[model samples]
Target: MTTAPVRSRWEEQRSFDELGRPLRDVTFCVVDLETTGGSVGDGDRITEIGAVKVRGGEVIGEFQTLVNPDTAIPAFIAVLTGITNGMVADAPPISSALPAFLEFARGSVLVAHNAGFDVGFLRHFAREQDLPWPDFEVVDTVKLARRVVTRDEAPNHKLSSLARVFRSGTTPNHRALADARATVDVLHGLMERLGSLGVHTLEELQTYSSKVAAAQRRKRHLADRLPHAPGVYLFCDDQSRVLYVGTSKDLRKRVRSYFTASETRSRIGEMVRLASSVTGIECATPLEAEVRELRLIAEHKPSYNRRSRFPEKVTFVKLTREPWPRLSLVKRVLDDDADYLGPFSSRSAAESCLAALHETFPIRQCSDKFGRHPSRSACVLAELGRCLSPCDGSVDSSTYAAVVRQLRDALLRHPDDVVELVNAKMAALAEQERFEEAGVHRDRLASFVRAAARTQRLTSLTRCPEVVATRRDDGGRWCVHVIRHGRLAAAGVIPSGVDARSYVEQLRVSAETVVPSIGPIPAATAEESERILRWLELPGIRLVEVDGEWTCPVRGAGRPHPSTATS
Candidate 1:
């Protein structure tokens, strides 16, 4: 049997379709430096600074300064440049020259024949002298020349060779100012070559000569019409099938990044190449965008989305159904009669919550298949007063069931009892001068409270049968979301300059309906509940309508106003 060839998924696309700022609009600062000796690490110092700032191919500013190297010049260097220790005796120190150079070069792209050498010295001195180093974007003419002019066109990519080839007005004389002027002409010449290739933006010019394939550059038009707003974007293939779904605060910026050279993900590049068009669903707030992203990922199950697709993967803490029920952290919730505390963020959090509960309650610790009559030996925890000793038949089932009820009450009904018990134990420990033990109790109490608060906040959203809310978007528009049974059911935008009252009734009728399960608790996973709760907590969002009771605790674990709530 023959097998089909495996096609590569990584596609290369343009960073953006719309041409960004033109090269003429950008400012370029061509710089050059002369050093006392070789390496700065070997105690070498900068002797002379020269730079020419240009905009639209015209010199806008110039910076030149001679500095005392604070060391004697070598004999060979003095003969080469005709500068000696006596020549620079009246010149200012590099510390004084660097400030003026940096100010002149501010907000401009630094260009040099060999940029690394020049920029490295400046950076090293800036750090040593405790001066603010200008974080300038740099372009190396050497690298750009290598990509633009081949060996046949130019024997070498050196500044002098390029200067002779391009016929730059100045000739190199081993002086900083003359070399910098030559570099400015070279920079403009290279930019002209880049402009012929349709490279306009600074980003495009920087990555223009990259090894990315021509096909990748052609795909730059894919993200052309995407809105620059907070929203979920879908990448659809030629068949109009959704290949990937993503959420971003700025849809255009994020999507455009996939085509740039900086995008390192091979698979994402492949996915983008297969995609023919990109569509964005705008939202009023980031929270709404995130919720929509989660919902779409779950609904579409796109080939590229790997997270939150399996809602069943969420971990839950529940009591086992048996004569001697024990608190257990489980991934799946069964139909068996058992009380649950979460859909926690992780199994470790559920385990931590279980440990906190165990610290206060005398529940069973062993995970044994308990029989009608006890036959197993008692563990060390029973002797230490940790467990009720159900394995040894020391504790009756009825008494254990009553303890289970209290555990359930602490987890679900009211977490205040647990908080009060921990507080009292901590107070007793402190009163007895057992400060170390009291501190341990305090930390465990804090962990328990934090976990409980997160749990209750999420659970409150699930408990609500229906929720309707609205928030203002960046464009002065209102967005409405209708959540049904803890899942995002519908979302619509209300444009600016329109009376909200006129559209609210029609939107409410068109909103999707979800019948809540006729049970004491809402049916939802941790991911779904958290998504809904996060959307509700957005700033300036107002709860317009609610079908069922949805509130945090008044006395215990998940209370919003903990200061006012009594322990």
Candidate 2:
């Protein structure tokens, strides 16, 4: 017979015997519970119990009992769990079953998966029954599996998970006897892995533990310092060139979390080396801060931003008041003719703004060009009072166009005007002794005020009627602008990797989307295009020389803009 080792509680807790040397000793209980879906409270009781006793990594005894839950099993649980009301009808109550379990598990560590849920039921049971809750140290095999199992390499980590890990394919009975035995099997599997990792010392095993009690105290200190509010945050390098920008509902507390440094791959430490200091921009609400943070990150594309998208490179509602007036997002900038509505930070942002405008001004944003679609009556939005109903013929083209213009001016050019108008109305209401009505206007005005304030505007853009975007423009570099009205909407550069002249279809794919002709102005005539030709004397900017053809110069190298480049 293979003689198994024996263990005492002190060996389980301390690893070393009185000899002061490492002893492979531990006392563990593989425990399982069957409950009335059963209650510890309100007269609910345990339906069954099963457990195995293991010491020094050897199972020496087993225990099992069925307790009357004193009630019907919940229908859903009964169907899935295979444990029915009849099995517990003649069994002992929890009062008797629990004592047997305590005697069997004396002086051993408990092991379970998702341990807290099972433990909580027992804790509540004891509290309700006026019994002192049983206490024992525990090790969650689930958390242990997380550290040892090679995620995809292992099939799973449930009792069945461990079964497969160790090829201990004991058929799953799920009965108290079967589950208790499976748990014993699981503990053995963990011991094998733990032994393989040379985890003989109690101190060593504790180091890798996912102990909740210890982690909670540490988190408490971290939370006390983090401000519970809304704001923007910055991760900066030593020189203060922002590496990443973020906004949160809370300021101080979010920044404070990095110092705990418990896990290597968590939030703060991953980005800490790139951060020398933190900066913040506080906003009154999460909504406003989220919107602004998006816009700022897009415009800056801070090097350390983990998120994969940019702001200014967005789809927007471009309103054009030209040959035939209408609204839609333009994807090109042929020869600037109409004004522009956005370089909105996102397509959703653009759409949401359009929805708001539709409610206020009744503008159309659809692919069907003006007068192109027949049966020119009001669109669906008109019936909802969200639109002016220009398509349905309820409103004429001139009136529709005027409303579109007002919305265009309000969103892109001057948002403050809407705020001013609402504020004026609110003031008049207060003067007329209509205080309640005035309050409504006051709230509406605040929204407009905040919206206007949130958008970080590029100043004095009105002077440049024809907006320009220049990015090397060698067949490799593409300069594009998506415009709104007759004025500049948004402009930027995109470096296409292909050579300038070859594969012209893909090469000419406009980074520029145009809306209503803004008519190209002298300022946008590509002074650099002319200057580069004069200096380099090359035909079309040569971004790359591919297959004997020329491409844009800025393509593929992933170089930063001149402004962001270090000297």
Off by over 4 Å in 2: 1-23, 38-45, 211-567
TM-score of each: 0.73, 0.34
Candidates in order have lDDT scores of 0.76, 0.51
Q: How do the residues 427-519 of candidate 2 rate in per-residue lDDT, one tens digit apiece?
A: 788899998876655544443333332221221222222333233433343433322222222322333454534333232243234333232
| Top TM-score model | 1
Candidate 1 per-residue lDDT over residues 72-172, each given as its tens digit? 98888877766778978999998898888888899999988889899999999999889988779888888788878988878888888999888899987
Candidate 1 residue runs with Cα over 4 Å from true position: 1-17, 37-43, 73-83, 128-135, 236-242, 270-285, 320-324, 333-338, 344-362, 365-386, 396-453, 461-567
Q: After superposition, how far is residue 124 of candidate 2 from its true place, in Å?
A: 1.7
